[model samples]
Target: MIYTVTLNPSIDYVVYPDEPIQLGQLNRISKHHKYPGGKGINVSRILSELAIESTALGFVGGFTGDFLKQQLQDRAVSTAFVEVEEDTRINVKIKGESETEINGAGPHITPEKQAELVSKFRQLKQGDIVVLAGSKPSGLPGDFYQQLIRLITEKGASFIIDTTGDELMQSLEHQPFLIKPNRDELEELYETVIDSKEAVVQYGRDLLNKGARHVIVSMGKDGAMLFTHEGIYHGSAKPGRLVNSVGAGDSMVAGFTGTFEQTKDIKEAFRYSLACGSATAFSEDLAVKEDIEKVLQTITIKQWEE
Candidate 1:
């Protein structure tokens, strides 16, 4: 089984403005839409699109949480979220001449609630994959993710972590099943400018040497590269107009992890990863199964030689 953890989830409210807005003045929007918003939740939703069953685990509360939960349930995605006292957050995205975002702080998770979420991990067994994504809610210990990694590793299950900065650096020692870092995040991790493909391969190998079992460096329109112990592979899909950027990375992570688990074929997984990401990029929202299939037809993966 695959489990995705989203510690802080939200209802993403996207509003479209009829015209340019003036500061400090009343503005009106032509339309708006709401969707369950969280990195891990996005993965589970993408996995469902691939016909793979996954259970979403995280913290949720109040009416906003209810709306988020219902949204997932309606998509046939299972969730095992811990309820909290305060209501879950609502993130507002205003789309005018430019996009602007206002994110919420989310609910605080008490110790008891934290322990409850940990206990759920105890049930994980070998062959299960746990995807830990996004940031945790406030009030939890900084080592919360580390603790969960220990439990997951002890149970013999593999894990994938998609985060940035120190949290990402810290997880390498446990040897996560996979880690997907975009070009910018990769540069930020090593604190160096990567101006060439050679630099990318060098730094990607550095991540492998640091203990990541598998690493994928996503470079937007430039395509993505996969680094494994055996060799490196590069993948790309036919170019398409970019409609949305949100959730594209999570979709890639889900595509690679889910397909790899089932087929154990790195090339196939990389192909699906590119297709899923491109499909999402070409859609107003996350890609559906049909969209993925359409994009898959344009995907190409080749072994990369240095």
Candidate 2:
């Protein structure tokens, strides 16, 4: 079974306006909708669209938490998470000429509540893939990913981590099975801006040297690069217009891990990942199986010789 962890989840309330807004005038919302959102939640949603079953883990509380779980259950995705004291937060996304996001601080997980998560993870055995996705909530320790990686590794189950900045930097020592960092994240890690494909691939190898088993540097629209001890592989994105870039990288991670869990072929998995990402980029929401398959047929994989 595949498992995904979303330490902090939120209900994304998206508001769209029909007309331009005046500086001092009150703008009326023409349409608004709420969706279950979070990096891990998006990953699980994509996995479900692919006909793969996955269990979502994390801390949820109050009515919003109940709604989030109901949304997931409505989509046919299973979840096993602990409850906390505070209510889950809601993020307001105002879409107009430009998108504006107001994110909220979620519930705090006490040490005992956090321990319950660890105990739940301990039940996984070999062949089960665990994905620790997204950032830690406020009041949680910084080394949270590091701790989960160690725990899953100790249980003999391979793990995939998708986070950037310090959360990713601190977990490198655990040597996760895979780590997906986008181009900006790659630049941040090396403290240098990458201008060419060669520089991106080179820096990807640098992460492997730092103890990451496999490093995937995702370049939106340009595609993604996969670096391992074996060699460097490049997958091209299918030609498509970008409707929404949100969760595209997370979908790539989900597609790669989801396919890898079945095929275990790095290159094939990357191709599927590219398609999944591009598919999501071409839509306003995460891609479904048909959406992903359409692009999968056109995605081309090229091997770069060092």
Candidate 3:
């Protein structure tokens, strides 16, 4: 079984206008839709599209929380959320001539609630995969994921994390199953400009040396690269117009995890992950199984001769 953790989730309200807006003039919304928004939630949704079953674990509360869980349930995704004291927040995304967004600061997570989440995670059996995804809510300790990584890895369950900065660097000591960082994130981690592919592979290998079993560097349209003990593999993205870049990385993580869980082949997982990410990038929403499949045929993975 695979489990995904969303420390902070939100109801993403997307609105669209048919015409241009004028300063000091009111604009009317032509269309609007709401979707469950969070890095972990996106992963679970993608996994479901691939016909994989996984549990979503997080803290949700109030009417917005209810809506998030219902949205997941409607898509046939199972959720195990801790009810909290405050309502879950809403994120508003406006799409007109240009895309605009206003994100929310979700409700505070109490220590007691945090501990309960930890307890829930303790039940995972060996060989189960848990994805500790997204940013932490306010008031949580900086080492929150560090602690979770330690706990889950100690219990014999491998974990994947999608975060950067000190939090990610700290968790490396626990040896996460995988870490997916973008080009900018890589620069942030190493605090230097990566001027060439050699430097990219070198810094990535440095993370592997720091105890990360595998590291995936997402390079947008240029494609993504996978680094592991076996060897380095690169997957070039299929040509497509970018409809939405949101959730692309999460989709990549889900695709890699889902395929690896079933096939345990790093190469196959690398190919599938690029397809999943490109599929999402080519669509307004997270990629469906069909979209991912179409992109898979165009995926080409090459060995990096470093």
Candidate 4:
């Protein structure tokens, strides 16, 4: 079974305005939509749309949290989130001239609440896949992901980590199965500009040297490069006008993990990852199986066997 961990999840309230948004004034919304959001939650949603079953684990509370849980169930994704003391957050995304975001801080997770989450992690078996994604909540320590990875690795489970900055840096010591960091993140890690594919691939390799078994350096539109302990692989992004890039990376992680679980083929997995991202980029929501397959056919995966 595949398990996804979202430490901080929310109800994404996406508001579309008919006209430009005015700052410090009441803006009228033309349309609105809500989705079960947070990086790992998005991964589970996309995985379900691709016909892969995954259990979403996280902390949730209040009526808003109930709504978010129902949203996932409505999409046929299994969830086992712990009930916390505070209400879940509602992230507002006002879409008009450009996107404007106002994010809320959810409930503080106490030691007992965190222990409950760790207990859930203990249920994973040796062969199961676990994905730890998104940010650490305000109340949590920076080493949260590292601690989770250490516990999950001890269970002999394969893992995928999708986060940036120090949290991501610290988790590398656990040697996660996969880590997906976008171009900007790559730059931050190396503290240099990545202007060429060689530079990106080299930096991804550097992460592997530091203990990550597999590294995927994603370049929006330009495509993504995958580096394993064995070799490197490349897949190009599909040609299309991006409607929404919000869940694209999470979709890519889902696609890659889902395909890797089924085939254990790295290149094919990269194709699926690129396809899923492109599909999500071309739509307002996450990519479905049909859209992902269509993009999959157009993506070519080349291997750098050396």
Per TM-score, the best of the predicted structures is 1
The TM-score measured for candidate 3 stands at 0.97
lDDT (tens digit, per residue) of candidate 2 on 66-160: 99999999998899989988988899988888888899999988999988998997898988888888878998887777778888888899888
> Once superposed on the true structure, which residue ranges of model 2 sit more than 4 Å away at CA?
22-25
RMSD of each: 0.9, 1.5, 1.2, 1.4
Can you write out model 1's per-residue Cα lDDT over 158-205, one digit (the tens) per residue? 999999999999999999989999999999999999988889999999
lDDT of 1 at 200: 94
Q: In lDDT terms, which candidate is top?
A: 1
Which runs of model 1 end up more than 4 angstroms from their true locations?
none
Per-residue lDDT of model 3, residues 196-251, tens digit only: 77888999999999999999999887788899998988888768999999999999
| Model 2 steric clash pairs | none
Query: Order of candidates by lDDT, top first?
Result: 1, 3, 2, 4
Please list the residue runs of candidate 4 whose C-alpha ends up more than 4 Å from where it truly belongs after superposition: none
**TM-score per candidate, in order?**
0.98, 0.95, 0.97, 0.96
Every candidate's lDDT? 0.94, 0.87, 0.90, 0.87
lDDT of 4 by residue, 7-95 (tens): 99998899998778877988787699988889999999988988889999989999998998898888888999999989999999888
Q: Clash pairs of candidate 4?
A: none
Q: What is the Cα-based TM-score of model 1?
A: 0.98
RMSD of 4: 1.4
Candidate 3's clash total is 0
